[model samples]
Target: MKLHNISFNNLRRRKTKMAFLTIGLVVGIATIVTLVTLTNSMSSDIGRKMDEFGANILITPQQNGLSMNYGGISLGGVNFDQKEIRESDLALISTIRNSRNISAVAPKVVGAVEVDRHQVLLVGVQFDKELKLKQWWNVFGKAPERGDELLLGSEAARVLNVMSGDTIDIKGEKFKVSGILDQTGSQDDSLIFSQLPVAQRLLHKEGRLSFVEVAALCSGCPIGDMVLQIAEKLPAAKVSAIQQVVEGRLKTLDQFRRFSYAMAGVVVFIGSLIVFVTMMGSVNERTTEIGVFRAIGFRKSHIMRIILLEAAVVGVLAGVLGYAAGMGGAKLALPMMAEGKQVQLVWDGVVAAGSLGLSVVLALLGSLYPALHASKLDPTEALRAL
Candidate 1:
């Protein structure tokens, strides 16, 4: 009979012991796969949602300012003219190398306007892009879609004594209050939002942008590189990244990935230990059988191969069954782990292949010492056990 046939027959004879070993390996592999899959899915979902929270790149006109100090005393100095970023220059942002990472670009034109004799800051924005960038905005009414419609902040509406559906005059033009934003604890809570063209016309700064907000925090986006590229494209504009926001989100995702890996390591160690202990026990029980084979002219290599073959078979079975169980567990556990977010499980062929290979390699390593011990047994000494 061939060496593999002997290994197969031995496994069939020791069903109970082999089953225990298989179960241990399967459980470990399944736990690992489940943790890794869940972490990846949750990180992706959270990253996408966080990316939509706000803009990570800020584009503003670069201005020159002078500071005057005399005799250790500070004094206000003359300021140079503030350069305006042309609205037409925004298209250059799309020409950057990492432009594909850019999600939303909100161009804003800010100026002061008078309403009911009260000075209010008027921020011009493209409603479509603005609304998309600020998904967290809770408006009391609908967003403005027309030049004659206006969205008011909480403080702006309160100070102006206006609500949704109220008409207000700005610079002698009548604008309907389409919505009042909830108090956001930011400057936005005291400003009025209007259509880009209308505000530009009222502010007399046509085709000029005060600043731009770009959302570009996608998976693996190089934020620093993107800032430099955008700055290179718009030389007159100062482009900078909001480091705190990007860093916070990245740190959270990194923690998730690291946690999964750490847990997987622990499981892998335990799985290997189980395989080692079980294989050692099996080898000890078959010492007399090993002696019989040695006396029949079986080589040490053959004996070793037979022992390893058994482990290889068990590892293969464990890998397949483990992967199936892991995916099922991940699907069931996703809802609770994702903070109620519904995340879909992805069947990655590469992960499946890796898990299979990992199981086999671990099995071989765990059984290596036991196999060696079995091969080195003396025929006479082992036969005494018979």
Candidate 2:
């Protein structure tokens, strides 16, 4: 009999066993697919959040008395005098030789202000410069044109029960609401933006900026090193990068990714064992059939090929079905997993092909040992057991 015919007949005869083995493999493949998908999605999500923050490098006054301990040892905090960046420092940055990607620079002076019963963050920003930051802000009216005009974040607008053309009292000074930025689910969505001079005046801060938001021209540049270089040049002002903060969070997430990978490995290992045992059991139950094949002059090599072919067919079929099911499962579960955060899954053809390829390889590995054992069976011993 042809190897193909023998394999097909064996699979049909042991339908229940094949079905169980396939289910085990499908579970493992689905798990692996979900983890990989989530890992990629999270990386993209973190990058998007960083982009919304606008500034690649953030400059802030170093906080006092922060310390850390390692190996049961404590290290004292490095203290530096608090100094604000001047307009001269901004100009100096513009002149740096390798700072070509320094696109837009804006200084922010943040403070607290009371509007009726509401306490809000008062942000003094350069209106013209902030436009180059990003597309985070969509003004409902016009951008701030003068000291009297202010833009509120969407949440802030809803809280204050005010909109465009309305005036809100901040620290007893009335300012016209010129615009309201669309919500981006960040710190910006809770603050008020006004001309820097206006904010400084309202907050009683003169010629002093709390921090400078510097938008870099290059997206994938090494921002931490750039921040360090900037800090070295402007010894008076401290520098912080948005990428640094995002990377710190990503490090923590890396631990979770490792855990997910380990879990997937465990699940796949168990699934492979189940497939091996199931195939072995099917071989034992079909000993009489094997004897009949040997009687019909089937070569040992042909029997081996039949067993392996059955395994390969089962593996491929399960892999395709598992991939389809995994994709569908991810689509349905992504939003729920994100906990109301806006997320997007970008499907790459390469990733999909790789995932399916991995599934096939795993399936074949799972069936190899069982297929070998079945191929080595003695027809005389198999018939005697039957």
Leading candidate by lDDT: 1
Relative to the true structure, how large is the alpha-carbon lDDT of every model?
A: 0.91, 0.77
- Candidate 1 — worst ten consecutive residues by lDDT sum? 338-347
Task: Please tell me which predicted candidate would have the highest TM-score against the true structure.
Answer: 1
Off by over 4 Å in 2: 54-56, 60-105, 108-138, 144-210, 215-223, 241-252, 292-298, 346-351, 380-386
Give one digit per residue, the lDDT tens place, for model 1 in 1-386: 89999999999999999999999989988998898888777777767666766898999999989999999899988779778799999999999999999999999999998899999999999999998899889999999989999999999999999999999999789999999999889899999999999999999999999999999877778989999999999999999898685577568768978988998999999999999999999999999999999999999999999999999999999999999999899999889877555566767787799778888888998999999999999999998887
**Global lDDT for candidate 2?**
0.77
The collision pairs in model 2 are: 58-240
* Global local distance difference test of model 1: 0.91
lDDT of 2 by residue, 1-386 (tens): 56798789878987888898888878877777777777667667766665555777787765555577889898756655556666556676765555876767888899999887989999998888888686567778889898999999988999998999999987778899998888878888899998898888888787888888887735355676677778877888778766656566677668768977898889778877877788778777777877777767877777777777887788787777777777777777778755345888756566577666766676667667766776677878777865
